[model samples]
Target: MERLLAPVKAFLHGETPSSWIEEARRPERLAVVLQDHLLCELKAAQTAVWLLRRYALDKGGSERLKGWLRPFEDRVYRPCLVKEHQAMASEVTPAGLSCRPDAPLAGPLVEKMVRLIKEELHHFEQVRTLMLARGIVIEPIRASRYAASLMQLVRSGDPWVLVDRLIIGAYIEARSCERFAALAPHMDEEVQRFYVSLLRSEARHYQDYLALAQMASPEPIDARVREIGEAEWRLIAEPDALFRFHSGVPSAL
Candidate 1:
């Protein structure tokens, strides 16, 4: 476990301070943070779905992919679920649709992506449960700039495109894990424990995304990973225009 989590520890504890966690645990702040947390988890799951559907799955499979997200989408965004709890509530068990991985592309990419999708979905459910326990009302908010900024670095070609996307994925997972660790110290016992527990799985998700990126391209992925890593650091460290979960230091709204 130590070996598996070494990178995660280094990333989280290196620059992040102990005080941030202290602030995040306040009950007064819990509702706002939980709202952001809920959206972030859903976005993470959405991102995985987009990746697999765009790169690995066929057209027919991709349509099914949209169907898989329909339940949550309908309830939260579409207003079609009817029941009050179902309409405005989030699920405690993150939901996901199974993919048909037998066709077209077959490799570790498929395996890793599918596993990632499952984990992300589970994280979504966990966050939703936390929100429910706290009575944090669910509402839609615009996305943070973190993802868009990272994606701007993607190259304009096949292998490079895929490689860049994977590197971005690595950074996203790594940053999420890092933030969780940073914020855990300030959190209440329950939230703190949850964040700590997420470190291992989140660490694996980062590595898995990087490994897949390397597999997809013939070029060495290190330099590109480093480039993207620097970009990610800036995104986290610099001032931002939004306060969504992955947004940089909170800016004045």
Candidate 2:
């Protein structure tokens, strides 16, 4: 665990504040946290799909990915179909993920992201199962500003755009891993074990994102990383109106 978190801690700009952890462990907040976390897993998988569609995959590959993701997507967007979607959780095999012949770094990108999507969807099912066992029904919750605010930094060109998105991805994954570590000890036994279990894959996801960003960039990305790191830090270290898995410090804490 130390080996996994050492780089994650170094890569991230700020740690999740103690106050947010305190607020999150409250009984009233568990449902909210798990709900948002469930959605976050879905969003993470969706982001990977977006990357494959835009940068790695051919039309057939993208469609196959979309079909695999539809049930998960519907589970979030259509809360009434929760039980229906639960049955399809094990059906996320996105076979035939063919990439474009001319797409640079397509092979590594496809391999890494395909693995990431599978893990994230699996995590989604795990969280959902926990919620069900606790009698927590899936409900709609507004997204926190953390991710959307970071994405505003993405540039509007080919390599620059991809580079910026990948850097942002690294930050998101790093933050998730860091928070999981921070929250584990405070959670109940079941939740703590689950959060701890996520640390390895989440850590790797951040590293994979950073490596991809660096590879896709035409030059050193230190400056760009520092720039985005600062933004991510502000989002974490500042006061936030809402409580979420990735939200900033809670004002009400």
Whose lDDT is greatest here? 2
* Model 2 regions lying over 4 Å from their true place: 79-95
RMSD (Å) of each candidate, 1 decimal: 4.2, 1.7
Error of 1 at 1 (Å): 7.8
Candidate 2 lDDT by residue in tens digits, 1-253: 8888999989887788898999999989999999999999999999999999999889989998897787787777876665553445456554667889889978878888888988998998899889999998787689999999999999998899999999999999999999999999999999999999999999999999999999999999999999999999999999998889999989964
**Taking the tens digit of each residue's C-alpha lDDT, what string does model 1 give over 51-112?**
77767666665776666566565544754463544422223212333345553333465577
TM-score of each: 0.82, 0.95
In candidate 2, list every pair of residues with a backbone clash.
none
lDDT of 2 at 112: 87
